[model samples]
Target: MTSAEPGAEPLALSGVLTAAEADDTARAIAGEQRADGAIPWFAGHHLDPWDHVEAAMALDTAGRHEQAAAAYDWLARHQNPDGSWYAAYAEGDATRPTDLGRESNFCAYPAVGVLHHYLATGDEAFRRRMWPVVHAAVEFTLGLQQEGGQLGWRRDPDGTPVTDALLTGSSSVYQSLRCALALADLAATPQPDWELALGRLGHAVRHHPERFLDKSRYSMDWYYPVLGGVLRGSAARARLAGGWDDFVIPDLGVRCVRTNPWVTGGESAELALALWTMGLERRAVEVLRSIGHLRAEGGLYWTGYVYADEAVWPAELTTWTAGSLLLAVAALTGDTATRAVFGGAGLPRGLEADCCA
Candidate 1:
């Protein structure tokens, strides 16, 4: 795969990962990619659309463009007739479905990956090739959006719509929608409905948390609106401050849930991304550094560490964990595309909704 420019600055975090270490981490993620380009949580683990795209974006962050493009090509080739992917796939044979559900966020995430790749490499052919895939996927996801603008989590295997929405999932969808619109602009095909949907979704995320499930105990719910670009300015700052003590443990990392004693690499890195979006660079770097314990010998990070039990839970090294950290580091190290995507500076804000209504 193509690499970054030889004279570029390294994605190194002081007192944490060096340039070599970062390269090793990227390679560790690439190693988990299947021959067909699917990246499972770990070797032999089930592949989920959301995590798969997350890992692919990381490859692009590390200048693994060819590998990342292959990953997107795999998604395009295997997409369902309805433009959505199954929730989980058998790692051994990704063409075989493991979980038959279709998550809206999972279906919508390819837009983010595609847009990131396009921004990173300026690949016009790649953008055109994936346009229809992204279009259909966004349509499938928006079909599940409730009247309040929050999207239902998923469709059952049998095509049943479960109308309950998730704050974190829909927040993620909000971010993906913005990315899709960015791609749409590049393709010269505007999606006005998507813009309206974006406004409603943003309102649901910012003003109507009651519309979503009470997942306040989860750290993602605490930070995803900020990370997902729906919440910002003083409101974003206030949200992070409110939840910092509950979720972040000093010298550890972010916990997956409020009551849990385990700190997960994925969530921690994602929090760093949120912090970086807020221009809190020092906090973001510190958050990234705190999770150094989860970095295993092979450069892949453990899924999480259970500080209460003094053990690494699940005994697994995940590509997404490393992927998330790489993305955060990429943003921190002045990767313009990564910064633009996560920072919400270049992406459209969509139509604004009347929150009072």
Candidate 2:
């Protein structure tokens, strides 16, 4: 491709992460990995299963399938008997600490990671191993669902539920449920509860946001529904369009909070991924331009801005921040260079009419 007319370079880090840049970022994140295979946000913090899974997926996108699977195996080794992962694990191979115990979302996310690993390798054995985990996790998670159909955010090791459902948290559970159902379908397991759970969640997401006890000021609450395929058709299209004025800056990408001046790498990058999944390629490019200010040296990304001030409030460069950007980039461009980092897979299956019913 020729040079831009005058100022055609990518305007944001969302898209500005060149294949080489992405490679470096991916490697840097990988370097932080512990001997036990958990990837923490930075060097010192404990590793949560979700971040490990995201980083693993990033590895897949970067074409490091073996490394990615090892991450998954790390998760598999720590997999709870009830089909869940603990809320957090200490970094490295030493004795793991479970101060936070198990989290619902953490437990559910691995279903996606395992399914992706299977897609990349066509390993039925992995599928066989994960199939029961996926089912038990979904079943256990569904028990945390409230009467309003929102999911509880966490649980004690004894299976006692913690906080009420959160919009973003449940959105993820919704995604996991669909992935679980897809696995069940492939294995011919026929999970009626899985279907029922997804259907209930789709309704909560589409019809009753208030039911979710929503503290959804973040951009994650903005596009993840669409990205998760929980929203579609005219209603989905409208939600995507409606958020533009409040959350997006066509030139700068997305705001981290709906009312805040802060724009963050993780939020913007995730928004791009959501848009790309929705087939909004040009808009995804816009998000990419907004985050271009992100630096290449930091294997991590700025968490968010203080406002239009351009100063990063959260000075930390999180692994998931970079991971979100990579996943978004791969989906937006279908660029083969990034494709090798992950499997050449389509979006996970969305819930059908009676997914939860």
RMSD in angstroms between candidate 1 and the native structure over all alpha carbons? 1.4
The estimated TM-scores of all candidates read 0.97, 0.85
Show model 2 residue runs off by greater than 4 Å: 1-15, 92-101, 335-357
Q: Write the per-residue lDDT of candidate 1 for residues 274-351, one digit (tens) a residue.
A: 999999999999999999999999799999999999999989999999999999999988897788788878898889
Tens digit per residue, CA lDDT, model 2, 21-75: 7667777777777766777877887778788888777766666666776787776
Q: Candidate 1 local accuracy as lDDT? A: 0.91
TM-score of 1: 0.97
lDDT of all the models against the reference? Answer: 0.91, 0.69
